[model samples]
Structure formats: structure tokens, C-alpha cells
Target: MIKRIFAALLCAMAAACLSGCAEQTPPPEEHTGTRIALSMASRDQFLVTVETSVLEHAAKNQVDCTVWDAGNDYVVQMQHVKDAREQGYDALIVNEVSPSLTRGILREAEDMPVVFVNREPEMSALTVGKNAYVGSDDSEPGRFQAAWLNDYAEEKGLEHLNIVYLTGIEGQASTIARRESLMDHLKVDHDFVYDSTAQFDRAKAQVQVGMLIEAGRSFDAIVAQNDEMAIGAAMAMQAAGKELCPILGIDGTIAGCQGIRDGMLSFTVRQPGDEQGRAAVDAALALIAGESLDTVSGVTLGEDELSLMIPYEPVDAENVEEYIS
Candidate 1:
């Protein structure tokens, strides 16, 4: 009887160990609610603001969102697309490193809905029902700049002004559109005394502008595709003990707005990063729910019905305080 009791006790102990093991074992990952993957081209300051807005909006709507920075590499962005697909993300929002690579990104995404933000892609790669582009019109900012500059020229009684043009990344759609539109819309006769690509980098702009100053290149005003380059040009002028001219920039970033208040930047066109980001998220959610892109508020669909544009606002010293905070 004692031997029988010992065998029963051993069996009971074995049963308890098995039960504990079973309890410790993790269950299969349950596919829960909607999930979205936001793949950014890089962690630039402007993009960071957009990212934050995206995250905040997603959370408010009870959606699971993940972000991946591609570090300005198309190859990495493609990999991220693949991972998002394999990991069962319901949708993707990408800020493409190169607009030319949009087709490859679309191919990698397969049937997954993608909302491209900030960087506009080729129209051919976008489909009305499958993919979409959400951002401000690139040409609009340039026109806004041109309007302000034209008024400044008129006020200064300058018939023909010598301008220094600082461009963004060479071959970028924004760079091309902004430069062309600014040139096309400006009312005053202006000669581009200096023109070069600053690659949207502040240091590069500073260095290039300093070299122009050192060489005694005469210019009445400076125009940059983005705020960073504009501020850099301002810095170069200050260092040379030159009075600041009408320095124009785009993006209306915090620094840019502050520059306006400080008399460093004359004005900037606000691109509304926060609005773009929130709209992108809303667009993604709408797509996930099988709704039309137009359902997303405060965005206007393009003529092709594949792009959604948020309007740009102009900020100058007169109203710089409104944008600064």
C-alpha cells in the first residue's frame, strides 16, 4: 500500500510540472485590430514633426501604428515595405527616399494600400483606388515666396534685382517645381547671380553662401527652397558683416519663424507638416476601412484623384509670432 502511495505521489508531481509548463508557454499572437506601418525617408526635423502628428492621431483613433526610418535609402525602404507586409500590417504610409523609386516600393507593397507623404511621387506610380499621395503643393510655396519678394522689390524701388538662389536636393521634384515656379511668378526682373544645390543642408548652404560672399558676388536677395538653407545663408551674411536682405525660405519651421522674428529670415511659406501627417493617417485609416480618399477632411484631391494637397500658408515678420510657438 505504501509503495502504491509513493507511485501516485510521483505521478501527481509530474502532472503539476506539466501543468506549470503549459501555463508558461506563450499563446500564438492573436491578430488583433488594425495595424499600420509608417516608413519615413529620414528623421529630419520637418519629418519628425509629421511623425509625431501621425502617432498622436493614430493613438487617438485606437489604431496600432509603427514607424521605421529608412535613413534616406531606397533599399532600406523597400526592405521595410517587405517587413510590413510579412508582419501583417494592414496598411503602409511611406515618405519615399527617392520619388523615382515609388514603383519599386509599390511592387514590394503588393496589394497593400500605401499612402505616400511629403515627397511627391511620379503620377504614373499612383492609383486612385490603391495608393495615394498626401502633401502640400510644391509649386505653391514658390509662388508664395515670389509674391512676397515681388512686393519687397517694389517697396525697395528696385527695378531689377540680383538674386542668389539656393536649391534643395538636385533632381528632387520639390526642388525643380519650387525653383521654376519662383522664377515664373516673380514680377520683377531678376538675375540669379548665384545658383547652386545646397542639398537641403544648412552647413552646405552656409559654406556655399560664405564662398559667394568671399568672392564678392553681388546679390539683392536670397531665396532658398527650404528654411534650413535660408537660415544658413542668413548666417553667412551675418558673419560677413553684411546687412540682411530679403531672405526667403519655405516650410515655416520653428527656426524659420524665429528667424523672421529675429530679422534673420524675411519670410517663409508654411507647409503645415502637422496637417499633412494627420491627413495621411486619416487617409490610411479610411483606406483600411474600404472608404474613399475624399472622406478624409481638410484635403483636396488632385485632378488625377490620386493626390491630396494641403494648402500652404505664408509667414512673415508681421505675423511671425502666430507661427513661432
Candidate 2:
């Protein structure tokens, strides 16, 4: 009996020692560099918000960072990604030019860490690179924007309502998703007529609107995918003596909100820029520690790279004074 009790005690002691050793193990080594590489499709109010948010977060965390503007060119952004990877950036963030180009980006990363923010990529998996991912859901913005537009249309009793959708860089993911989702809702539910997609660049959107006006076409509403295009469309509408149309935009930038206050913009939506910026840092940190982004799953941009779909709500003249300008 004495021998049996002694043996049991020895076994218990060994198990406790193992459990303590496991519990006391330190986390994995962090990445060696303080540098991060960031690229955006272009510099605009919306992109600026995302950039500023990321830069500000990096600054606060004492992380060294460099940002590049792709000038709205997929080729240029592609080269930038290749260069960033070669230079050994600790982590990379890209606001992709289009959904189609995203896989190419992943392939070029060479197993380095990468993440996409507001603009989601088209890859079908949660993991794109060895330690990276695209972003949050692409459909949430569509639903939110569609529901608001539908409600507003219903309230105003808008029939034969015409809206012009302005997009960013032709094939960009957010731009395409926003347009398709809104159009689908309009066609099947609201019976709205939103015709044509105008590139979201300020000059281009204005030019597109001008062509429509010159051709004797008219729109009852002008909807821009981002604030830059919305403001540009407004300028063109005023120039063409078409100011009677209601105008709406996304990316509730300071300027966009100001436009709403001035009665020039009927509404716009806000994205979670700060959260995305911080998320990129958090993801990189997790990767460096040999942990998976899956650890932050519930909060990781819908459990992928920081691809979280934040709700964008309508901001109009009614609430413009309180929130904008």
C-alpha cells in the first residue's frame, strides 16, 4: 500500500511539472523588421482615409512604414508589390486595383505576409499568402447601400428614377461589388433605373457625366462609389445646368460631409478605416509570433485578412450638420 501511494504521488508530480512547463513556454520570436509596405490604387479622399488611418496607427506603434500610390494602374501596383516583397518588408498591405489582379499579387508575395483592407480581393480562400489574406466580406456594403437607396426612393416616391453609378479604376473589387449589389437590389426590389458605371476618378467621372449631358441624356440622381467621384459628378452637373438631381456618394470624407451640409450631396457612407489600419498591425504581430490570424477570427475582417465589412449608413442633409462640416 505504501509503495502504491508513493508511485501515485510521483506520477502526479511529473504531470504537474509538464503542465507548468507547457504553460510557461514563451511566445514565438517577433518579425525582425519595423518596416511595413503599403500600396493603394490611388490617392483620393477614401484612399486617404485608409492611408491616414494606417499611417497614424503605425506611427503610434513606433513602426517604420512607407506608402505608395499606384496611380490607379494595376501594372504599377503589381510592380510595387514585387518590389516591396523583394525589399523584405515585414508585412504588406494593398488596396488592390481590381479583383482580377489580387491573385497575381498573392503569387508575387513569395510567401511573405500580406493583407488587403477596404478593397477585398477575388481569391476564394481565407488564406492567400503563407501568412496573409484578402479582407472582410464584400457583400455587406452592397446590401447597406441598396437598402438605404431603396428606402429613400420609396420615401420620395421616385418613379422612373435614374441614377448614375461611378466606380473606381474600372475593375476594382469594392467598385464592382457596390455597383452589382446596388443594381441587383434596384432591379429586383426597388425597380430603380441606375444606368452606366463612371470611373470614380474626379476628372473621369465628370467627363462621363458631361458626355451623357452632351448627348441629351439626363439622370435624376448621381451615385458615386466614393466621395471624389461624387464631388466631381456634382461639379459636372452644376456645369451642365443639371443641379436638379439628387446626389449621393460613399466614403464620407470631410469634404463629402461638407458637400452634404451645403445641400450639394444628399448622402454618403462611412467605412471603418481606423479599425482596418490597426488590424493590419495586429495581423502582422500575430504572424510574427507564429500564431495564425485565425486567433482573431471572430474579429479578423470576417475571419480572413482584415476583410471585415463595416456597415456604412446614410448621411444626408438632415444629419449632415451634426456629423459633417
* Local accuracy of candidate 1 as per-residue lDDT tens digits, 1-325: 9999999999999999999998999986654488999999887667888999999998878789999999988789999999999999999999888888889888888989999999888879777788888998899989998998889888888899899999988777899999889988999998999999998889999999999999988899999999999999999999999999889999989989999999999989998999999999999988888888889899998788778899999999888888876
lDDT value, residue 198 of candidate 2 = 62
How high is each candidate's TM-score? 0.88, 0.77
lDDT of 1 at 322: 88
Give the per-residue lDDT digits (tens) of candidate 2, residues 181-260.
77666632332344555666778888877887888876677777777788888888889887547777876778889988
Candidate that would win on lDDT: 1
The 10 consecutive residues of candidate 1 with the worst lDDT sum are 26-35
Q: Which parts of model 1 have CA positions greater than 4 angstroms off? A: 1-32
Best candidate, TM-score: 1
Candidate 1 TM-score versus the reference: 0.88
